[model samples]
Each structure stands twice: as structure tokens, then as C-alpha cells.
Target: MIEARQLTKRYGDKVAVDGVDFTVRPGAVTGFLGPNGAGKSTTMRMIIGLDAPTAGTVTVNGRRYAQHSAPLREVGALLEARSIHPGRSAFDHLMALAYTHGISRARVSEVIEMTGLQSVARKRAGAFSLGMGQRLGIAAAVLGDPQTVMLDEPVNGLDPEGVLWIRNLLTGLAAEGRTVFVSSHLMSEMALVADHLIIVGRGRVLADTTVRDLVLQAGGDTVVVATDDPAELRRVLVGPGVEITGHPGSEQLTVTGLPAREIGRKAAEHGLVLFELTAKTVSLEEAFMELTKESVEYHAASTTGRAA
Candidate 1:
């Protein structure tokens, strides 16, 4: 398991990571998510001892990452996929890492095959493509058979097949009771694979909850109403704690602060002709956008042409 308490990091006068706290338990996959410049990478770096925390503590399997006698055996991480020496072959690189930790040549071969790098095992590391580099990084990560696995953007350069493979690999690791923590900007993939989430915004913990709960919480009151007469329906539904949105002449209305059944009842009582009424369940992407809208570091301007 991975745990952090009041973990903080600062660079000069800027705070990179705030007093963050979250736990990644074994037998589950936890996704780390945030917008650009939200301190996600910085937080991950501190977890693996890449950077020192200004305050608080973080532990991997009950101890700091550097304190472990065989760090690889305790935690396997793919922080940077391209952090290998250019002069070394894939096999040579794995062998070097194995030698330091007393890992065997057989294990090295096994990982090479596991990551589907057998054909290019003897190829120079610098010549490999981004997808191949990702595979090599993963092979090195699991080479020690560690109890915890952490990866940052493992699918950055992967194709469709590779992305699918990673999804299965993450779930498989967690199935074996390993603590699997991954950081990704892909919300759709995270929604499918992650059992829980640790979301950050501007270096602070914005949410720490399960996938289902987050979506439900964000979508609880949202309802879609289709009616023949939207104007009259809107007038009837307008009240305290209610929000309605739609084009003036549109037949559909997006309503919040009211339940679907309540709207149906009110419509029926008013004898309004209704076409459809749906309690909209917000998707993972929608929930994420709503939660992080205010925390987004950059905003793109409208593409609509302005008057010259």
C-alpha cells in the first residue's frame, strides 16, 4: 500500500504540491487525475523519492522508497519511459538493473518476453519507438516483482492494442493484491479501469473517492426534459434551487435542482405535452470537467472569427 500524510513540496517561492493526503491500497487500481500544472507529476515524483517533500511524509509498503534495502522489490515505477542510457541494448539495460539487485538472468528473459520485447531485446535503447520504450520501461518496472506498481502516463505513445494491453496489465496486477497507482489524463480509460480516484487541482486534493460515487454525486440532480412546449414548462419549473437551460425555441431542456419524477408530476399536473424525461447520469469526463473547471491553469480562446 502507498500512504501520504500532509505531503508537501515547494520550489523556490512556488508551492508545487500542497498538503496532500491519500492512500492507495492493495488489490485495487487508483487513478491520479488533474488538469495541466496541477502538481500531479510533482506529487508522483515525491512518492518515489525523486524529490524531497518540504513537509509531511510518504511511505511505500510502510517505509520511504529510499530506505528499502531492495527498493525495486518493494515498489516498481515507470516514472520516465525514456530514462535509459542510449548506448545500452534493451537486454543490457535490464541485465544491469538485475545485477544490482541480485535478480537473475532468467528473470530478465522472462520480463523481456512478458513485455513483448523479445524480438528487439538486443536492439539499442535509443533506437526504439515510443511504444517500444514504454514496453521496456514496464518490463523494468515489474522485473523485481514488487508489491506496488506506479506508472505515469503509461499509454502516452501507445496504439489501440497497447492501450488495451495496459488496461489488462493494471487490473491483473491489482488482482494479485499489488498496489497499482497510475496517473493519466485519459478520463475514458480511467473510468473503465480505476476502482478509485485521487483527483488534484492546483496542488491540493480535490477529491478522493470511487469512480461510481464521483459521477453520481456530480449528476444527482441533473435531468433532461423534452417537451412540445418548452416555454410553458420552463415557466412552471422555474423556482428556488432550480436551473434550466436550453435554446429559446428548442424542444429540449436541461434542468437541475429537481428530480425527474418531480418534473414529470409537475408537467402532468399542468397538462403539458411531454416527449421525454430523463435523469441524466453525468459521465466521468463531465464530472471531471465540472470539478476542475475553476482549477484549470489554461483556457483556450473561442475559435469564432472576430470582426476585423
Candidate 2:
């Protein structure tokens, strides 16, 4: 598990990361989400000791990353996939990393095959495509079979197949009771793989909750009701804090602040015939936008038509 207590980072006069506290437990895939320039990279760097925290502390598996006898075996990370040497082959790169911590050659071979890098294992790292480089990076990360795995934008250059492979790999790692923390800009993928989320804005954490809860909180449960008599149904269901809207002359009513069960019960008591009563679920992207609207640093201007 990874824990951070009041972690802070400052570069000159600017505070890159404010006092942030979070606990990433094992056996679950935790997604790290934020807009660009939200201190996510800074926080990740501080976690692995790439940058010293100005105050507070962070630990991987109950100890600082530097304190571990074999740091790579304790926590494996892929901050940048293209940080490899141009002259070395993929096999040589993993072998070099394994050699540092006395890892076996068999393990290096294992990771190569695990990441599907065997075909190009002997090719120079510099000549590899973006997707292949990402694979190599992942192979290096799991080289020591670390107890914790942290990856930033692991699917950046991946195709559909590679993306699916990484998704399965992350879930499989978490299933093994390892701490899995991944940062990604893809909300749809995060919703699919992550069990929990840590969202940051600016320099502070904006939210720490499960993916489902966040969505429900941001976009409350909406119930769509279809009935022949829309006006009568709206009047029957009207109450304090309950919102009901429908287009003119439409049979469907979009409702908020009430569950399908309660709506059905009310409709039955009022002797109204209901054709449909279904709860509408919100997407993670919508929730993220709703919660972080104020925290977003960049906003594009509205475009009316094609540029001249």
C-alpha cells in the first residue's frame, strides 16, 4: 500500500503540490485523475522519491522508497515510457534493470513475454514504435515483481488490443493483492478498470471516493418516466426538492431527486398508468466535469462555425 500524509512540494516560489493526504490500499485498482497542471505528476514524482517533498511524508509498503533494500522489488513504476537508452535493445534494458537488484534472467524473459515484447526483444529501443516502447516500459516495471505498481498514462500510445491487454494486466495485478495505482486521462477506461479514484485539481485533492459514488454524487440519480398523461403524472409527483422536466407534448418526463420505486408507488396510488420507469446512470466523464468545473485551469472558447 501507498500512503501520503500532508505531502507538499514547491518549486522556487510556486507550490506545485499543496498539502495532500491519501491512502492507496492494496487489492484494488485506484485511478489518479486530474486536468493538466494539477500537480499529479509532481505527486507521483514525490511518491517514488524522484522529487523531495517540501513537507510531510509518503511511504510505499510502510517505508520510504529509498529505505527499501531492493526498491524495485518493493515498488515498480512507469513514469515515462520513452526514458530508455537509445542504444540498448528491449531485452538488454530489462536485463540491466534486473541485474541492478540481482533479479534472474528468467524473470526478465518472463516479463518480456508477459508484455508481448518477445518479437521485438532484440531490436534497438530507439527504433521501437510508441506502442512497443510502452510495452517495454511495462516489462521493466514488473521486472522485479514488485508488491506495488504505479503507472502514469499506461495506454497513451497503445492500440485497441494493447489497451485491452493493459486493462486486463492491471486488474490481474490487483487480483493478486498488489497495490495498483494508475493515472490516466481516459475517463471511459478508468470507469471500466478502477474500483476507486483520487481526483486532484490545482495543487490539492478534490475528491477521494469510489467511481460509482462520485458519479451519483455529481449527477444525482435521474429517473425517466413515460406515461400517457404527462401533465397529470407531473402534478402527482411534484414535491419539494424534486425536479421534473419534459419537452412540450412529450410523454416522457425526466425526473431527479426521487427513485423509481417511490415514483412507481406514487403513480400507483394516484391511479396513473406508467409505460416506463427507468433510472438513468451518469458517466464518469460527466461526473468529473461537474465536480472539477471550478478547478479546471484551461477553458477553450466556444466555436460558432468553421474558421475563415
Candidate 3:
């Protein structure tokens, strides 16, 4: 597990991350998300000991990363794929990273094959495409068989096939009981793979919970009912906590604070003929947008700026 207590970071007079506390547990893919300047990279850097925290403590498996005798065996990270040497082959790049942790040549070849880089394993790193470069980076990360895997935008340059591969790979890793903390901008893919989420806005956590729970919190289900006798149905559906809205001249009535079943049962009891009664739950993307809209640090000005 990864834990942070009152984690904070500062640069000159600017504060990138505030005193926020959160945990990334094992056995699930926990997505780390935030706006562009939300201190995600800064926090990840601090986690891996690449940058010293301005204050507070962060630990992996109950010990600081720097204290681990073999950090790579404990955790694998792929923060930047383009850091590899352009002069080396994909195989050579993995080999070099493997040698750092005293890994064997067999292990290097194994990861190369695991990430589907075998076909281009002998190709120079400079010649590989963006997707291939991402694959090589992943191979280097898993070369040591680390217990925890942290990837920042692992699917940034991946094609559809590559994206699907990473999704399955991360889920498989979590199923094997490894800690997987990933960050991605693709909400659709994140919704598909992540079991838990850590959403940050302006460097502070907005949510730390399961995906299902977050969606439920977004809002109650909206029930849409279309009836020939709209006025009669609306009169019967009126009650405390139930809010009904109409679109001016439209026949559809959107009701909140009641489930579809309840609405249908009420309609049947009142002998009202309904054309449609559907419950619509809020989506993850919508929830994220709502939560971050207020916390967004920058906003594009409206069309036609006022006189300077």
C-alpha cells in the first residue's frame, strides 16, 4: 500500500500540492486523476524519491522509497517513456534498466515479449513509433517483477489495440494482487479499468472512493415519463422530495427523487397511460466534470475579450 500523510509541496511562493492525505491500496487499479497543473506529477515524483517533499511523509509498503534496499523490486514506475536513450534498441533499453537491478538477460527478454515488443525488440529506440516507445517503457517497468506498478498516462500514445492490451494487462496485474496506481486522461478507459479512483483538483483531493459510489453521489436517477395526459400524470406524481420539470411545450416530464419502478407503479394505480418511463443515472464523466469545474485553476476567457 501507498500512504501519504499531510503531503505538501511548494516552489518559491507557489504551492503545488496542499496538505492532503490519501492511500493507494493493493489488489486494485486506483486511478490518479487531476487537472493539467494539479500536482499529480509532483506527487508521483515525491513518491518515488525523485523529489523531496517540502513537508510531511510518504511511504510505500510502510517504508519510505529511499529506505528500500531494492526499490525496483518493491515498485515499478513508468513516468516518462521518452527518457530512454535514442541510440539503443528497445531490447537494449530494457537490458540496461534490468542491469541496474541485477536482473538477468532472460528476464529482460521475458518483459520484451510480455509487452508485445518482440517484433521490434531489435529496432533502435529512435526508430520506434510512439506506441512502441510506450510498450518498451512498460517492459522496462515490469522487468523486475515489482509488487506495485505506477504508470502515468501509460496509454498516451497507444492505438486501439495497444489501449486494450494495457487495460487487460493492468487488470491482470491487479488480479495477481499487485498494487496498480495509474493516471490517465481518458475517462472512458478509466471507467472501464479502474476499480477505485483518486480525483485531485488544484492539487487537493476531490474524491477518494469506488467508482460506483461516486456515480451514485453525482445525483439521483432522473426518470423521464411521457404520457398523453401529462397534466393528470404530473398531478398524481407530485410529492415531497420529488422534483418534476418540463421542457416548455414538450410532453416529457423529468422526475427526480423517485425510482422508475415507483413511478410506474404509481402510474398504473392511477390508470395513466405512459409512453415512456426510463431512469437515467449520471455518468462518471459527468460527475468528474461537475466536481472539477469549480476547482479548475484556469478558464478560457469568453469570446471577444473586453477592452484591455
Candidate 4:
């Protein structure tokens, strides 16, 4: 488990991370999401003790990262894939890390094979592709076999197969009762992988909830109905706190805050047939955009002085 309580950070006059509180439980994948310059990286850095928080604190399991007796064994993080020395071979790099912890070469080999880096373990880090570098970083993170794993943008540039591999790897790690916390700007990938989400914006925590709850909060389970007898439907739907709007051209009426079953029953009672009555679900990307639209800091004003 990971707990960030009112974690705050500032650089001169600019505040990178405001007072933000969040919790990441074990046995599930928690996604940390935000736009560019949204302080997500800063927060993650603070969690791993890479950056000092100006106020508050972050803890893994029961203690702060620096307070842990064996930090590597408690938490493993892949913050940036390019943190490795460019000239060092992948195998040599892992060996160096193992030497610090008195870990065996067999353990190093296990991580290399686990991350599928066996083929290029002897290759220099500088010559590896972005995808390969990412895999190597993940290999190093998991080398200690930590109970909590945190990765920032784990799949920045990778082939489809590589992406799929990482997805399964993280799922497997979480299934093993390890806490997996990932941060990414990829909404679609997060939707497919994360069981819970922590949405941040402008150096503050905007939302910390399950993926299901976030989607439900977007107020999306509305059914769209199209019919030739929109007037009759409108008249029947009028009053009683029901909203009916014209659906651009045709005699279609869009009813809001109504269930599909009730709409069907009411239509039948009114002797009206619905040409199209289907429930429209909002995608994760769409829901994210709608929820974060007002929180976006930078925007280009259109000709009407509104955001473009």
C-alpha cells in the first residue's frame, strides 16, 4: 500500500505539486493520470525520495521510503528509462545494482529473462531502442522483487507486441499481491489496465476514485432516441423534470435523464415507434476530456474568445 498525505512541492515561485492526498492499495493497478506539466512526475519523484517534498509526506507500506531498512526490497520504481549509463551493457548495469545489495548473479539473470532482455543483455545501453530501454528499466526495477512497483509512462515508445507484453507483466505483478502504481497520459491504455485512477490537474488532486466511479461521475448512461413523431414524444416528455431537445434535422428528439426501458414503455403507451433507441456510452477518453476541460491551464482562444 502507498499513502500520499498532503504531499506538496515547490520550485522557487512555481508550485510543482500542491497538497495532494491519495492511496494505492495492493492487488490492484492504480493509474496516476494528468496532462503535461500537471505535477504527476513531481509527485512520483517525491514518493520514491528522489525529490524532497516541501510539505507533508508519502509512505510505502508503513514507512517513508528513506526510512525503510531495505528500500529496494520495499519499493521499486522505473521513473525514467534513460537513467542508465549509456556505455554500460544491460547485464553489467544489473550486476552493478545487484552488487550494492549483495544480490546474486542468478537473481540478475532471473530479471533479465523475466523482462525478455536476454537477447540483448550484452548490448550497450546506448544502442538499445526506446522499447528495449524501457524493458531494461523495468527489469532493474523488478530485480529486487519489491512488493510495491511504480512506473511512470512505462510504454512511451514501443511496438504493439511490446505494449501487450508490458500490460500482461504488470497484471501478473499485481496478481501476485504486489501493489502496482502506474502513471501515464495514455487514457485508453490506462482504461484497459487500471482498476482505480488518481486524476491530477494543475498541481492538485482533481479526483481519486475507481475507474468505474469516474466513468459513472461523467453522467453518461443516457439513451439516445430518434423517432418521426418527436412532437408527440416531446409533449409526453414535457414537464415532470424531463428534458427534451431537438436532434439536429429530422423529427428526432433527444431525451435526457431517462432510462431506455421507461422510454420504450412510454413510447409504446403513446403509440409511437422509436426508429432508433440505443444507449450511448462515453469512452474513457471522452469522459476524461469532459472532466478535465475546465481544469486545463493552457489553451488557445478561438475567434469567439473561448477555448479552441
- Candidate 1: where are CA atoms >4 Å away? 225-274, 279-281
Per-residue lDDT tens digits for candidate 2, residues 1-308, read 99999999999998888999999999999999999889999999999999999999999999999999999999999999999999999999999998899999999989999999989999999999999999998888899999999999999899999999999999999999999999999999999999999999988999999998898787558999999999999999899979999999999999988899999999999999999999987899999988888888888888879596
* TM-scores for all predictions: 0.84, 0.89, 0.88, 0.86
Off by over 4 Å in 3: 228-253, 257-270, 301-308
The number of clashing residue pairs in each candidate reads: 0, 0, 0, 0
State the number of backbone clashes in model 1.
0
Q: Which lDDT values do the candidates have, in the order given? A: 0.94, 0.94, 0.89, 0.88
Error of 3 at 295 (Å): 2.1
Tens-place lDDT per residue, model 3, 260-307, is 999999999999988998888788888888878987777887878577
Candidate 4, residues 187-305, lDDT tens digits: the string is 88988999889998889988888786777567565667888878888777677756677855677666667777889888899999889898767777788888788778788656885
Structure candidate 1, residue pairs in collision: none
What would the per-residue lDDT of candidate 1 be over residues 163-185, giving only the tens digit for each residue?
A: 99999999999999999999999
> Ten consecutive residues with minimal summed lDDT in candidate 4?
247-256
Error of 3 at 264 (Å): 3.8
- Pairwise lDDT winner, candidates 1 and 3: 1
Give candidate 3's whole-model lDDT: 0.89
Where model 4 places Cα greater than 4 Å from the true spot, the runs are 228-272, 300-308
